[model samples]
Target: MDPLFEFLLRQGDNTLVLGHRISEWCGKAPVLEEDIALANTALDLIGQTQMWLGYAAEVEGAGRTADDLAFLRDAWDFRNLLLLERPNGDFGHTMMRQFLFDAYQIQNLKALEASSDPRIAEIAVKSGKEATYHLDRSRDTVIALGDGTSESNARMQSALDALWPYAGEMFLADEIDQAMAADHIAPLPLEYRAPWEAAVLPALAAAALKVPQDDFAHQGGKTGRRHSEHLGHMLATMQVLQRSYPGATW
Candidate 1:
């Protein structure tokens, strides 16, 4: 597989999966304002996915559109991070996951703004704007909830402990990362990890959430070798419309 296509899949799939997960909160959010915000964020992520996956399709030259790549592929074909695929256990858990991913994206997208590939740079720039808002919203929510009453604090802490292991995979530099870095198309995991940690650690501390000590990370999402059962379930719902309709449109 072309490294660029693979790289685009990682970017697109992350947003696609995470966007779908976030969308689960659309009508179900705790507050009306929050429901709107969550829906808007989901739209932002799916918009980003369109850009990334559309580029990927062009690169692959396989006559597949972005919608096809997104809705038609099975679980094994996705290359998103494992953390994003985890079920939205609760409001706290969802916010914690969003905060973690937003922090990671903010750092990397800023770096990607300088990518040698103009297409990548353009996508990064546009996505970076939305990402900035996402980080702010998720970070504030994490801090507020984590530092809130006993129940909220405990839930946030639990979410952190559960999701921390998955965070490590975002910084695991594989051969594809190395290749992108070598060509100046993208930075290696290490290149952005420092800033990601810098952004994340202080937030965790402020939230009174204890950062887990474990460095172990579950992998395979980015490689699509294996994904948690949650992803297949998500795809079943997200793809059902397109799959059943077979390119049906207005």
Candidate 2:
């Protein structure tokens, strides 16, 4: 496989898996308005995933479609950071997860827009606009939850604690990422983190949310070494139809 193709699949799979997880909140959000908002964001993410994955499939020249790359893949095949697959515990938990991730994604996509690879750059350019909105919406929710009722505040804090470890993986560059950077296919992960943190901290402060004190950041999922427990059930639900009826499609 071409290295760029592998890079594209990694990006697509990350969004697809996370989008699928977030879509679970469509009907279950604590508030009706929030439910709609989350659903819309999930749709945006899935749409972006489809475009990237479709391009990735073409690059691979393997005759696999976007659906094949998404639903047909097993847990081990997914390369999303663990933070995304962490179970959506509560409204606050969901918001916290979204807050951290959306911030990173906005910066990441903006950087990718300038990628030397035209296809990658084009996808990033288009996706960055949607990602900007996602970050803003998620940021507002984080602020609201953090500054809301006592229970909401505590729940948001707990969510941050539980989800923060997984965030370390987002900025840890590996051989694949380095290759992409060297080839001007993507930006260095560290370049995006500072700006992401700058945007996140003020929001956290306004929400009265404290950053997790834990210095130890978890890593290694990119190599498929470790994953969240929720991934199994998620995979079962997502892959059931594909597994049951291989190549079945509408």
Candidate 3:
């Protein structure tokens, strides 16, 4: 229950889950160019996961490696925000989901790059650059789709409405976050929320997307207490190769 362990795990879990979701589009994207783009973004996320989870393994001082932590954990043990685990409903939904997460993650990483913990800070710097690219891609897609044809606009708006509630979970401050902030290991989740809003709201407005007024945020992933059923299904697929051929590597 170390604060750093939990903090690092949560960071890894978010990228891992979302990356897997994005990877689902490898061959299914709307166009050939988009397919390649989505795949590349997924790779970026998976790479980020390795850095974060690899560090978490070291911090835990346990025998578990990053692969063990990622491929062996049960559903309830994951600490990702719920937004990342939701099924990708459509192209619009996928972009909206990425936009929401990228907003918070980019800000979080920027602050993390200055961490009192040098290891975390180094990882943050590397990952933060990747996040900046992700934000640009997602933001551009959100704006273009939201301001496009009536049908595209409607779909983008719907995606925003469905995904907005989950966004609040990214900013929820629990003891682990408070402790990390107190030690200068990381910023409090709330620290990024306002800037996240500032970046997102203007994008949403430009896209003609309305921000949902609902305050209900589905949480509990950080404490490893709750997860959508989708995560279990994702784990089943993601861990299969590792589980079937334990320790097999190139």
- The C-alpha lDDT values of all candidates are 0.94, 0.84, 0.92
How many steric clashes between backbone atoms does each model show?
0, 0, 0
**Residue 89 in model 1: lDDT:** 96
Pairs of residues at least 3 apart in sequence or in different chains that clash in candidate 1: none
Clashes of 1: 0
For each candidate, give its TM-score against the true structure.
0.98, 0.96, 0.97
Question: Where does candidate 2 have its weakest 10-residue lDDT segment?
Answer: 219-228
Candidate 2: residue pairs that collide: none
Per-residue lDDT of candidate 2, residues 27-142 (tens digit): 88888988898898889889999999999889989899898888887777777788788888887888888889899988888888888989888999899998888888889988
Q: Cα deviation in Å at residue 136, candidate 1? A: 0.5
TM-score of 3: 0.97
How much is the lDDT of residue 2 in candidate 2?
72
lDDT of 3 by residue, 71-184 (tens): 988899899988899999999999999999999999999999899999999999999988998999999999999999999999998998898889888888999988998999
Better of 1 and 2 by lDDT: 1
User: Quick one: ranking by TM-score, best first?
Assistant: 1, 3, 2
Q: Write the residue-wise lDDT of candidate 1 on 1-250 in tens digits.
A: 7988999999999999999999999888999988998999999999999999999999999999999899899999999999999999999999999999999999889999999999999999999999999999999999999999999999999999999999988988888898999999998877778888899999999999999998999999998888999999999999999889898888
